[model samples]
Target: MSFQSLQLAPELDQALATLQFSVPTPIQQQSIPLVLEGHDLLATAQTGTGKTAAFMLPILHRLLKEPEHNGKVRALVLAPTRELAQQVAANSEAYAQYTGLKVACIYGGANISPQEKALKAGVDVVVATPGRLLDHLLKGTLKLDKVSHLVFDEADRMLDMGFIGEIKRIMRHLPEQRQTLLFSATLDEQVQKLAAQWLAKPQRVGVDPENSAAEKVEQLFYAVDDDRKRELMSHLIGKNNWQQVLIFTRTKNMADEYAKELNKDGLPTLAIHGDKSQGARDKALAQFKSGKTRVLVATDVAARGIDIVDLNYVINAQLPFVAEDYIHRIGRTGRAGKAGMALSLVSIDEQWLLEELEVLLDERLTPQWLQGYEPDLTKVPKDNRKNSAKARKQRDKKHILGKRDQRRRKK
Candidate 1:
């Protein structure tokens, strides 16, 4: 359905029109009305599902309706990483442009003095990371007494990062009577516990099942030796002439090393990770986004906040340790309903990790061997092959039993 049917404010409707956002995504269609109705909400949707707008539009509308000038922070949005905070703040600014709302994004790894100044100047909405927001709160640079709306964007990620204590501390500062919204890519046990504690009789909205990647993403993997991963990646990019690619590595050092190797092979590349300063990270991101750098190598921590328009390729130079992160990594591509490709370069050592990812995805990923770079399967550890064979037999047995049961039912 069109966004107009959601009954957004006139100014918001104008903003949406200007942004060419006419149709609502599934998450937006289901959650916007519930949020506008003043109910606390618990939503689980995959990345690239327009979840930011689902909450931002309604929050901006509520702030405009109330018109609070006292400036004690009417709406607080807590993101897990600096990049995500910046993205949410950007979206908030765009959607609230016509309404004349003040938006400030605060996160660590940057100059906090300026953030403190912005908070002092007064803002209707504050999007911040948990650690940095707590710093401001403890330093008496910000207040949440007037906060009527609270949002935990990427709640699962925050919990994974061990920010649960910080989030709980931040919650203590907000007024007891408020509308709370928790948006997560997955509603696992940890997220459920957080919701139980925070939300007050919330409306549940789930657009897609947990651990599912975007339907438009074409997922495939290349089998190579650990030492040949970089060589294989370089060959694929050069052979395919990939213009803009976001590559995920498991560690900061790998991200830097991969970017350097790719650049040495005549590909303009940049690396972003936690070790880099905020200015450096921003510069690298801007370069990648502008196509000045054709490749951006990033670790899981640094990659959380990357939201680029038309980013068509996401390469897993190294598979994530957590299976769910595989979903988030590929999600960087296949955004805004566009077709995209997610390629993983799997080595012998990463076979176990790939198997875990397949279990989470509930489907087997067929492995492809590059013509010249095919891995030496004979060198794979005997134990690994044995385990793989055993797992395959179990799956075959289960499939045969299911088929037999279906035949019996028909008879």
Candidate 2:
């Protein structure tokens, strides 16, 4: 159904029309009505599913309809990363353009003076990261006592990054009675616990099944030797002439080293991780988006909230230890109903990790070996080691039972 049937305000309807958002995504369609009705919501939807608009539209409508000009934060959005927080703020500004609302984004890895000034000058909506928001709170530069709407975007990622304590602390500063909305890619145990603790009688909405990857993405893996991964990646990218590639590495050093190696091979790449300054990260992202950089090498932390339009390729130079992160990484591609490709370079050491991912996805990923770059399978697999341990335990158990039987016979 169209957004008009969702009972949005006239201004919001006009904004949607101007922005060419005539149709509503499934999450938006299910969530907008409940949010407009003032119900607490816990929503699970895949990345790149228009979740930002799902909550932003309803909140902007409420603000415009009620017209709160109290010079205090009326809406507080907590995002896990600076990029996501900035994106949320940008979307809020775009949707509220006609409605005359003030939106500000606050996050770490940047100067706080400007954020302090913006808070002091007054803003209706504050999109912030937990650490930076806490800094503002401690400095008495921001107030949430008048907050009527609270949103936790990417709740799972926030918890994964160890922001539970910060989230709880931030919650203590909000009003006792308010509308709470939580949006996550997966409703794992931690997300469920957060919902139970914070959301009051929430309305649940899920667009896709839990932990399911995008249907349009072609998921493939190549088994290569650890030292030959970079070679295989370069071969695939060069042979396919793939542009706008996003590669994920497990560590900052690996990301940097791989980016350098790719650039040396004439790939024109840039790396982004925690070690990079905010300015550097933003510049790298800008370059990539502008097509100035062919590849972006990133760690999981730096890759969060990356919404590159028409990003067609995502290479897993190194698989994540956590299975859920694999979903998020590949999600960078196959957005907005576009076909994309997700390729993973798996080595012998990561076989167990791949197995764990397969269990999570409920499907086995058959590995394809590249010519001249095949993995050496001479070493014992981790599964075999586990099996040997299990055998030893079984033998000990039999011995103990035999001795007990002998004692019983003597008795």
Name the best candidate (by lDDT). 1
Clashing pairs in 2: none
What is the Cα-based TM-score of model 2? Answer: 0.92
Report lDDT per candidate: 0.87, 0.87
* TM-scores for candidates 1 onward, in order: 0.93, 0.92
Q: Which window of ten consecutive residues has the lowest lDDT sum in model 1? A: 399-408
Tens digit of per-residue lDDT, candidate 2, span 138-206: 999998998999999999889888898999899999998999999998777778889999999999999
Clashes of 1: 0
- Quote the lDDT for 363 in model 2: 70
Q: Tell me how far the alpha carbon of residue 295 in candidate 1 is from the true structure, in angstroms, after superposition.
A: 0.5
